[model samples]
Target: MTLSSLPAPAAPTVSPWTLSAFWFGTAFHWLLLLIILIPANVVGFVGEANKGTYLGALTAVGAIMALVLPPLVGAHSDRTGKRLPYIRLGLAVNLAGLGVMALAASLMTGTNGFLVYVLGFLLVQFGNNYATAPYSALIPQLVPPSLRGRYSGVMGMLQAVGQLLGAVVAFAVGTLNLPVFVSFAVIAVVLLVPALITMRGVPETATPAPELAAGPTLSWQQLFSYQPFLWVFITRVLFALGQYSVQPFLQYYSVDVLNQKDGVTASSLLAGCIIVASILSAFLGGRISDRVGRKPVIYVAGTTMALTAILLLIAPGFGTALALAVVFGLGFGAFTSVDWALGSDAMPSAKSYARDMGIWHVAFVGPQFIGAPQGALLDWGNRQGDNLGYTLVFGIAAAFFMLGVLLVRNVPDTAHVKTAKA
Candidate 1:
């Protein structure tokens, strides 16, 4: 019933008996998760080099999937206490989907080839979403609310690392042919497997308090009546959609309009800039949020994003573009740094938290559908062939962040707020 009576929290045993292995495992898994997406975006964008319509549709599919699957999967994951099984299963499917993507990219060509590519992407989206919802849900279980910021921040930092590392490696490799694909595939397979092996417990942090949200039980619909939870959900969806919408298009705009010597060169450079800015900002913003309050941090990110969006609108050239990306990344890093802590604060029930989070994951995944394609369509329709569409997209994102700033204010302060007794 108390902390002392527990099994010493399993002592984090991993040969050397350190928490580093847990992080190492997480870093690797994070790589597997992020790199594929960056490269896929590069591939997809390059593939759409001339076909903006196709790119728009690609994101449209993701957006649709984002809206539909949450209640379905959220309900199911909630019923079950463990998330590892889903992770393993999802990775397995992802592996198969990657193989299909490789085959299609290598063998197929033309409009038909793009369709096959989309199908493979669909499989990937399903697998990744399945894994991610449960994966994020598992976080609150592994670490306490106190250490949540450190772990979340580190993971957030390393998440950028994974994206940057993958992008850098892909850039250095100089091609996306069979060999390059295999190299990443090896990384994905190798990292994904060890993450499960090192993590010994299932419910990794907290045991699902079934009494509050016991399932079999009800669907995620059980939480529909809980207004605070809904508020958090709305905030998350708006925030994610705005963020995701601007980014991929920005990557594309960077390559298409900026006249980089190489598209990969531009992507890798922008990625590096974003990653570094993100790490520093995440640390800075997170610490500030901890000291000042979460609302201020959200407001700062929203305001900064809005201003940066306008800057891009006014000056859509090389220096201005990178500047906006840097600012965007910093805003994102700050947001993500405290997001987990904030999410934990908002949850109506810690019982079945992972399942509840899986429902929340829908917001994170849903944006790819709405934002990405919309940007692409704007690009196609306007046919400016410049960064005009990107400017519009980010402008809309800034608006959403403003809305989020208002919403996040409603979330009560549940993070470490009081000083310890002297």
Candidate 2:
């Protein structure tokens, strides 16, 4: 069937509160994984010296799962014309993974523990991606083109709030020295409550079976030929690469570079600074993009992030690092706020919303697959003395941010381009 022949349902306008609720839980889970759970698990399993390499390997493997699973699941969701069912299934599986992870944490300090932890991590990745792939279609399916920037802003705000909560959770964990099982239980509750709220709050309309059967299908040839989507995808990949380069290693960086004895607390504080700053910028950035163009806001935001990363490289003390974290947060918030709007604008066909969004998701996870391996490089640089690995990695990240900013100029703004209906 031709794309133009498919029915275009009039999408009801949704409030920002309702539109952004689900992202709270999703972002919360991600924050915990990257900032708290995975790092601690790896460090406990291996001593500090080996932590980087092992953590990198574990993240790489998990990234592979994230890279591959979502697009396939989203395609299936498109075929079935269902999203909520997959979301529910994902929640169940994610909970089960948490249970396994709790068990693995109990056995910390052993090879067996590490292996079991890897298993749980993979399960978590699987569940999260499965849910997120289809859920990502909601913005395109529901919001009008004009309102997407505002909707995306609200989404970014909620996500930043979720990250803040995650940082709080990390603080509690560190202060109380919570047991592994207890920590997992806390995460499970945090994840479940918001997700349930979202499911109940957002309304979904299923495509009729005839429409589902006749909807335009995606092909490899069409995928590469879609210029706007391709450019957006590449830009997203570069931005994410810059993020992952610094994200997973902050705890180690605190301990080694800043000479902080309490790495967890220090890292949490840094994250809190970032999240707090991001919260301030996210909504404003989105709203601004609605008035100005997405590309301009992205240009400013990207430059800020790149500059802040460079400053972080030369920071002399933990206090200085904290300040830089806040600056980086401002840029990160604005970039993320407008990012979804840009991607939604670039979509080629409404019929393939889930599938295309899932493919776009690869731009986020795929970078982790490549960047996580830099842990080896980090270790090698540190071994050479003066913590040069961090300097090298952060430099690379800054370069990536600049490159992403430059490349984004090639993608036409939503106001100028119409989504393909072929």
Candidate 3:
């Protein structure tokens, strides 16, 4: 069938979410970083001797689930027109996985521990993606286009705050193996309960069942032909690749390369600095994107990230790393806040928002899978002697960031396009 033959999607009639609902809805993400990603990294670092390879394997395994599950559930949600049910289901799975992770890490030994942790993380990844995909779709579905930037900013703020709190907790538990896992498990529940409770009052804005009878079916060529979306997807894939290439190892780098006696302190300090800067930038970047547009903000963000990576290569000590974290945070905050809004603006169709967003998510998770190769690079580099592996990773990361900056230029700011059409 020709692309024109597909029915135009119905205009979305979603209402603005209340501040309370927004807060609760987003709170889940804040805790997600601390409970899931941070703990997984720490576990990977501590669980095995070859930290790079072990961490890589774990992340690679989890990436498969991250890649597969969300889009499936998201597509399902698109058809069923229910977002929260998946979220609730994901919560149960995540909580169960968290408990199992804690128990596994505590009871298992050596390689056994590593395997268990990997298993637990796969579950966490599944649960996390399942819940998050729908939540992500909510922005485009519910938020008025005019307010998308501001709303994204607010969401970014919540995420930054969550990271800040998570950083504090991560530092407290730093490298303490079972305690870190246990803490994450407990905190996940503590934060999640209120989020779920608060979200209970928020309305779901799914397409009606009758309306979905003849939903638009997209061909691969037709889907890829959407220039704005293609660019956005490509941009994020590069961004995630660069970001994760270094992210999982920052703590290890701090201790192993920087020679910090305390790895946990170093990691927490870096995260804290980024969070502090991100807190302000997240709000401001989002607000600014509303006025100026997303492309420029994203360009600035990508550039800042590239510069930050370069600085990491030459950073003198802990103090310098802290300072550079500020730069990184500024760029990250802007990119994260504005980029999300950009993605929403670039949605190909409201009828398949969840499904398309799932494909979009592949950009984010795709990097994790791609980055597994970097672990081999890390191992190869470290084997060569003078901590060359660390340097190489940062260099590659910087290159990726720069490339993303260039790519963003091609993606039209969908907000402006919409305005032009209006």
- What overall lDDT goes with each candidate model? 0.58, 0.83, 0.72
Residue 46, candidate 1: C-alpha displacement in angstroms: 9.9
Give TM-scores for every candidate, taking all chains together and pairing residue i with residue i.
0.79, 0.94, 0.88
Better of 2 and 3 by TM-score: 2
In the range 200-220, model 3's lDDT, one tens digit per residue, is 655655443344334464655
Runs in model 1 deviating more than 4 A are 1-50, 68-71, 175-180, 183-194, 197-206, 209-227, 384-387, 416-422
For candidate 2, the lDDT comes to: 0.83
Predicted structure 3: clash tally:
0
Against the correct fold, how does model 3 do in TM-score? Answer: 0.88
Can you write out model 2's per-residue Cα lDDT over 156-256, one digit (the tens) per residue? Answer: 99999999999999989999998778778888888899888777766565433354345556695686577778889999999999999889998888888
Look at candidate 1 and tell me the lDDT of residue 187.
52
Find the 10 residues in a row with the least total lDDT in model 3.
1-10
Error of 2 at 412 (Å): 1.6
| Cα lDDT, model 1, residue 308 | 70
Stretches of candidate 2 above 4 Å error?
A: 1-13, 204-215, 415-422
Model 1 agreement with the true structure over 283-364: per-residue lDDT tens digits? 6665665566566777787677667766766654677667767887788778777776566544555445655776776767
